[model samples]
Target: MAYQVLARKYRPRRFADVAGQDHVTVTLMNALTQQRIAHGYIFSGHRGIGKTTIARILAAALNCRNPIGSELRPLAEPCEVCESCTEIRAGNAVDVIEIDAATNRGIDEIRELRDAARYRPSRDRYKIYILDEAHQITDAAFNALLKTLEEPPDHVIFMMATTQPEDIPQTVRSRCQHFSFHAVKLVDILGEIRAIAAHENVDTDEAALALLAEAGDGSMRDALSIMDQAIASAPVEDGRPRLVAQQIRELMGTVPNAVFERILQAVNDNNSAEVMTTANQLLDAGNSPAQLARQAVRYLRNSLIAKISGLTPESAEGGAAAELLQISPDEQRRAARTAALFTEEELTRFLQTMLRTFDELGYRQEQRFHFELGLLKLVHLRRLLPVEEVLSQLAGGGGGSAPRAQSAVRPVAAAPAPRPTAPAAPADTRPAFSPFADTPNRERFQGISVGHQPEPVPVAKTAPPVAAPLPVAPPVPVAPPVAVAAPVSPPPALGVPPVVAASPLATPPGAAQPVAAPVEVVSPFSAPSTPPPPVPAPAPIPVAPPAAVASPFSAPAPATPVAAPPAPAPSAPGEPASHLQDAVVDALSNAKQGSASDAIGDANFILDGDTLKIQTMLSKIMLGVVVNADAEKILRLAVRQAGGPVNITLLPADPAMKAAEKKAKAPRSGSAQAKAMEHPIVQRAQSLFQAEIRNVIDLRED
Candidate 1:
């Protein structure tokens, strides 16, 4: 007999046999027991999570005969010996139909299914339709089946399985009862592996089985497949089954614990040389660059977690590291502590560098060199100061420089004072000969004095008197009396003018006044008399008037002023009013107006000023218009023709408008209006134009 592949040979036959999906199993069993079966069922989960297995089991339970007690009847755990259960398990059941939605996803296939559902089951109580990868079904097929799914026959059951639940239409989902499956846990996966190994008589350790469980990645099918490979690789001794960690690792091409440890130690010690050497060794051993990079990052992350929790690498528990590296909880904690020495930012930088280097490694034929280079760079980073210490040094300048002096001093000797009998004073005003002066210990003010010295009188000398030119007398003017004004007194009697008071000690008020004062005044006047005129008084300052105070009961101000602007002089009645004449001329000019009843001609007009009153033979309309004196008169006429309360904003023609108009009028292969009308969006807009014509006045380009 040919050897059956483990994935098929050990395929789950019943809900109880399905690994890592008890929740889903229990729910389905309860639904069947209570007879609360839904017409449509949707099973969604990752691949190998038993979506297809549970779906088949549910089908079996519904059709199983020879009821086991109520406890087991109508549940997922159907007896394999029963006809319905055994046939479904073998994929030979007549009533249970399995469809691969990926291949048969078309309207024709769905229409056939809809027609088949009208028939009764051949053997079982109900006919079951199992659609795998149901998301692959085409939209037309789904639409075709929508009516059938919403109201299927009493003897029909629809079981749809999809890994990507999001792809299914909302309408289809609303018609079904949905079940979500999760990946199997590591412990649960390991337990299943142990059970299978025991059944197969294969000898294995818990650690080896745990590794296999991890390699399975939560997929029972994958785990069993790997187990089959491991069993085949096991050495044969008397046909006994034997498996070991080394064999498992070798088969999976995983790095050994020792190699991982060596790489980790190199990084921790900041030994770039060792790190690169080890990386080269890994490559020489046939490890791919991407695989090596993934392992390195995993190791670093595990180390960080261990370091933060103060655990050795062996002690660390959880995360990818726990699942990949077979490190003990203690060792994991130790590695984590070592990783904690570096900051998250630093580690993240290292990881990013590794990522970039890995990208380069992929393209390089000689990947060992680039891989080693990346390792060396990462190790070198460990030698640099940690981010915190670097930040501290930057903040405070390392706190190791010398202090600087704040002040300087110098000594000085006193200079000799001038002779006391002479009027000249000493160069240094501070006294030098005082008893308390120049003493460092004396109080600041105790050594100081305050007083005035009398001026020295001129000494009368006994020199020979000049006897010649005997006694020439000088002319002396009469002295003027001091005049003091009193409030009620008339201006002081002018018999003698008030004396200009002379400063005291100026020849005792009788000395001749200086001649230099009059000479200085005369010198300034001798030059050109071009003195500037006095500044004029500033113009009267305008002050804002005080705000008016209204009585408490005064009426509120109108929101808008009611007074209308002055109207322009009406055109002479017989002279043909400007508006009517312009309208008549415009009517006569537009002879080729498209249609016989094209009212008002092609001319457009605007109303002028406020309270626009039109008096036309056809009808009368009032509109509000405000026109500036400089505004174009033609625009005012255009506003008047617009009629009603239309707000016709007349803008000054800008440079852009002039350019556009020029372009529009230029000769071309096609009319500019026709070209503009050609755009699909523009055509759509034109269709909508009439409906939105009333809103045009309020439309702004922006």
Candidate 2:
């Protein structure tokens, strides 16, 4: 009486009905047959791929009293006639408890379930708990049910399903076996659609079916729903369904293959007008800019795939042919001939432009204009050289003649030179004035000279310089001096040097005359004279050479006996005096004396390879070496010299470490140090000489 949505109507009823999940189904059937079912199971996969469906089917199989037999097991298929199977399928099963974890995600609900799980089942073989979207369960609920899940009652079974399996915690995952459901494949979905179409007696074309399958994108429920819509919208003539490609294409609002071909042709021909016309045509045909952009991206992607795989239309696969213009055999042969004309990089650049255009269209109100402009630019890009090419030409390659000509047609500013010199000045008479002539110090003009050299005049000395005396004729009457208190003598200057006066002049008798005072000048070089004590120089203290101060215990004066001069040291020189060796020995000795070296020897044994290897081993123990060679040697010698008695183990050098060491030590053609570091193995051996002595002495005594 009522129309049921295809998603609900086509919901999987049994394990066999589930698509693209044979591994999950077979495993569950085997579990039921062997009676080795766990108290809980978790199912996970993408949406609309039957995670919840499989959970329900498993619930039925677990409680099925009358089971159908198969080759591998006696209960592979649960009989739908059985009361438990029928009830579960109808969603009225008393024993099967289905809970939506999304709605009931709380500690209290889980506690109640845990308490109720203690009771025996009312009327079924097992009490099933199917929790959908189990990842949505609250942390408290998971913690509360952990104990019950680990050791649940014999009759209670938990079946959890989630689309996002990664969100589930490890504690829950470890408690139950996980079954992953994959998306249904396109071919499998098409098969299911065909079956449905036949049952409904709808006449659908192969191309239309392929479009539906491509649009479904690996979801059976979505494919069925799309098919239902397509069938309902099919134009009817004489009470028959007219399901064709054009009708489906109209329903989807996708551009046709011919339209995509025309767009590509316009771009290849560099026809801006055609590109704009095609864009307008698409708009007039009621296609949205976003949809057009998506179709263009798909078109470019298909072309690239076709160019790569060399598949022709006749031999092309279903979705590939519908979305991509299938290359004809002749075209494939031509593509090979023209392959050299366009490189992989060029195609990639073109595809990138299309993608960028799509992203721009998202923000653009005038998307058609932007789309047309993008296409025009992409078409003309081949005729124009890249900016890098132009730079290379200007850099002196001379390969950008055509591009340079096109660029010159437009007025562009020339590039500025890196270091432009100042222009030469002309010979001019009147003193050349500059805005910076008012410089504060005449010292700045010391090195600079004007062309006109004026003669230097002799100086006339000793004239009182015709001193302009104060006008003597006009005398103003003077007031009697007010008895103002004399200004207190200025406090002594705080380390300010005393000022020296050049000359002094006396004032007239009745005039105010300034007084001059004598000032003391301190010279930096002058020393204060002091009386010397009359004492004869004590007989020169008998001098002792440094050699005389050496004690017997002190290292016997580094035998200058003979400089066994400059011969190559022995391969295993005994404890070469390196700061690194001293540090390592100190650390080892400290760790041993303090009883903190329980794992030090083992840790050292692990650091004998590359720096990363050493770092990794030391990181585990929260102890690391401050010295490079010392850490490497301590590790090597601890293992080698420990004499198999101590619990020091040397992990074999990691292959990656060995490779890295080889790279580090390998002689680089131009580098001096490369030749000096030596092979890593040799360097590692050399580093161990001192550590070997220490290890022998320390562990041998132990």
- CA lDDT scores, all candidates in order: 0.58, 0.57
TM-score of each: 0.52, 0.50
The worst-scoring run of ten residues by lDDT in candidate 1 lies at 516-525
On residues 283-302, what C-alpha lDDT tens digit does candidate 2 reach at each position? 88889887887877765665
Question: In candidate 2, what residue range of length 10 has the lowest lDDT sum?
Answer: 556-565
Which regions of candidate 2 fall more than 4 Å away from where they truly are?
67-75, 106-112, 317-343, 350-702
Model 2 scores what on Cα lDDT? 0.57
lDDT for predicted candidate 1 compared with the true structure: 0.58
For model 1, what is the alpha-carbon lDDT of residue 424? 26
lDDT of 1 by residue, 88-157 (tens): 9989999999999999999999999999999999978999999999999998899999999999999999
Cα lDDT, model 1, residue 7: 78
